[model samples]
Target: MVQHSYAVGMFPATLISLKVKPMNNQEHDEAVLHRLLFQINMEIADQTPKERELFSNSSSHFIGPPQRIAEDNIRLGLMIVLFLAGTPLNVTAMMRLRRSMLSSATPLKQLKQHLNISDLMILLIYTSSQIVWLITVDWRSNDLMCKLLKFSHALCFSVSSNVIVCIAIHRFSMVFGKSTKRVTTVSLWVAWTLAVATSLPQFAVWTVYRPYETATWQQCVSIWFVREYDIRTKNKTLLAEPLISSTAYSVYHVLIVFWIPAALLIICYLRLAMVVSKEIYCECECVKQSQSTPLTNGNMPSTDQHVTSSRRLLSRIISFSSSSSGRFEKALMRHQCVTMRRKRNAIRTCLLLIVAYIFCWLPYNAFFLWGLIDHDSYQQWHNTSIAFLRYLIVVNSVTNPFIYLPNFRSALCSSHAVQS
Candidate 1:
């Protein structure tokens, strides 16, 4: 006899309908199983021990096509590469930032340091977790490990995005010549608070679920639907018991994690570009004027002793004032040059970070939103598209340290030397 029960699955879930009856021979059982497999649209199945064994033995007959296995293998390779590449890069970035902070402690540098830390979390928690996940192809760990890893996964994205937003705001302030230690401190606190609040829901949704008692395959996934018996039909049907509607959850996550931050980044960078352009234009005019100044004659005229003494006396007072004025002007120009260079470097680095963010995450979010709008699109979407987009998200974390640390190293180190 076959059991009737509901099954749950990962994202892009759909309702499943199946009919079951008692069967005597192996051929009859296989026929019924084939029909049930064709009808059920879920990844995990909940059934009795005997039926689960039967399902497991007969599963290969109609499941896990070669293309799906190849996609999984590709995803696994990508994750492993990202994990190995990102770990050392983020660690090196943090170390460099730490050294810079020791020499010259500034709020902007602190924000970047925090950004590196967020990237490290992504590498350490999320990327590595995915590597293991792809290898095992199931939840081999305990319930607590599943919850913690899932929570950390959510936390990594939330914290990294929030920190990037904070960096943009701080850079915007710097360009406008108005940055304060207090504002930076408050902004960081807010970023961390929001990240934690957004990630807390993962604990409620994700768990290690054993779909079959005698089966070793277990999944750590969201339990959005469960199987239940319908009294009228005496058949099992999937019932929704989600913490939040899937569409609503997707909307909230995408908005908080990408859309909102992207909007803010665009506004900040546009204004920043305008201000920097004007400043650079003004500098060009100053350079042209200085370069066009004519050279003075080298010859000197002979004069009498009394005339020379009178001229020399007057010249002493004039020279003193002129020297002081020249020194002050030189100091001012040097300071401005340093400030302008730093601003240009900041713009370059932030632009790279923003571009990388958009490039890496845009397709994934677009796919997610599209899937929410049209469920069939998600179901019919190519597995390669899904795997590639996911790989890109991890690539975002991997590329950040490279985008950030190299550009800032010279500037920060020089600033430190100047301060000393």
Candidate 2:
């Protein structure tokens, strides 16, 4: 029987590096040999032995395995596609939003402009960094680059999440008839402040280091994982601290970056939908009342009666401005039609954004939490699923610009038509 070793994907823990030779081709099938090799490799990888004699320098050098290099190439191609696709969309969105700002200058428009800016930042910072990182696949830089890159990743997530929440809040206020000028300005400032503050912890957690002194491979990873491996043989029972800390940080990160923002978006959009639906129902009822003709004895009104009713209705409409309160009501009604249309469009656009956000991020965040729950099983399956989840996240950034851009342009055209 021939012996073979297969290195599966990116993570070291998923490496199937052990040579597997079946006892006899007839006695043990290829399936059994592969399964047996997988089990043995997984166990050895988990040990993370510190002794230089345990793992050879060639295998320890963190060079991309055939499978991992292939994956990196695929990832690099996809990143380029995303970057190429997203850059123009975001840039066009920014230009249109800027023009809209000059034309109308609403707070809600300002919030959307900023949201697009944040998405662009994510596309440029996170996606670009990912492309470079995949190309190298090994840490060719110092510790500062490692920490800075991690920090940039965290910063992108936080900023994007917070800006989305801010958009939801601004839209909510707009539909509810609240003044959003000061609110929007303050909320934007707070969003950036919170994002920076939350991401600062990454500087302390990540660093570039080799797995072993004799190993040629260097990686930028959480120090906790490094320390866990370094002291693994010293006290096996003391392993819980680093794992606990890492899990805690993961929980905090997910909450701030995804869970909390998701909750806020759901609540805000649901309330906005309810309020807009109620207003639409009420408007329809008013229109039905106004259009219905008066009837006598369940028969159609005569011409004289119809003429009288028309005269009375016209007189009432004309007299609507007689009092100060009546004038205010007339003024409000004059703008109600336009306001209602604007509100409906806002709700629709925001709903699309919310749906895109949930669809793209739900699995990613779920997998992140699952990894914290079952590290071993997560490591086993993450090699296959992680790339897809990350792609979904990048796709969200690409889709965001398209989501709002068309809606904004249509609204702008409608406004121009109304003016004309």
Candidate 3:
């Protein structure tokens, strides 16, 4: 006899029995156990460990598709174009600025010379790093090369930004403050120091690492506070971790690079505009007063000699007042006009450069910030927009020389001519 019992929830148990000829007890139990084990094995074999983990953890990141070959070619092509065009322009700018400095030691001339040097250094470092990446097909084989490229990129970018800020500040001081020459010289040194200090962390934050031991592809990526996972497979994964959290870094970059400099520039230019306008108004008023003033002579003579002498006396009085105030006013107006013209030219040059920088970098920073806040959405946007944004950022360096130097070419040439 065999008996089996089953119980349903919230109900009494029921027992059922079947009568049969006696069999081996051990064999009967062994056969039932084997059937249960087989069913469990079949269920377990249906799912892989990775699949099970994916199902369990809904928050895991999804990798995006790799960049297409055509995209890579297009990017490399654009970089080459930038190198060809920007390199010569930057070199020319540096040479012209050097020659100008040799002829004059004025504060304004010194500022231009420093600006050219900064731009030249930036162009050389940025272009060289990019060319290396293009030649090596993204530095797949050389770990040291990757690190050097990443470091140079960061350092040059920071230096460029800080140099622009210093330029703006110098212009602002020249218009609004006393002792501008000394202040500008001090600021230039400080700017270079700050740039180097800020960019030094790139060395610690970035490195070339093979995420998968079996894969041939190696990535230049940030490894600070990073957690790496190695999954052996044919598909390659691209993952980067930064020393600071993405949110923090994004905020810091936007604040330091864009917002602060932009605010300073706007304030400086607005004040300069006011000063220029005031000078114009005062000059106009002075002219109106001078014209309205009537000539006075104490004695009127009938003789032609006396008349001529009287006219000459009136002219002398007008030119040289009792306090010489009229003569002083004329001198002041001439000085103001020259100063205003110089300030206007400086403002125009700086404004255009600032606009170019903002236009090129704004989109890239916007997308970078968006990526940090919503990664899944970022992945979708990145496929379409990242290429263009990256190109714009790199292209800014190329566009800068044209914007800065072309308008000033005549001036540079004239100075060179005068020196000769």
- Which candidate should be chosen as best, given lDDT against the real structure? 2
The 10 consecutive residues of candidate 2 with the worst lDDT sum are 36-45
Q: What clash count goes with each model?
A: 1, 0, 0
TM-score of 3: 0.66
Q: Comparing candidate 2 with candidate 3, which one achieves the higher TM-score?
A: 2
Query: Candidate 3 local accuracy as lDDT?
Result: 0.51
TM-score per candidate, in order? 0.72, 0.72, 0.66
Preferred candidate (TM-score higher): 1 or 3: 1
Model 1: CA > 4 A from native = 1-68, 225-244, 283-334, 374-381, 407-420
The order by descending lDDT is 2, 1, 3
Model 2 Cα RMSD, Å?
A: 9.2
- For model 3, residues 281-391, the per-residue Cα lDDT tens digits are 776676666646632332223254447758776656545553466466667667766766766677788788778877886776666556445544554455456556655
Report the alpha-carbon TM-score of model 1 versus the true structure.
0.72
Per-residue alpha-carbon lDDT of candidate 2 for residues 177-296, written as tens digits (9 for 90 to 100)? 777998899999999999889878878877766655665667665666466445432323354566556556656777887899999999998888898899878975664553363222
lDDT string for model 1 (96-180, tens) is 8899899999998899889888888878877666666556566677988866776777778878888888888888887666755
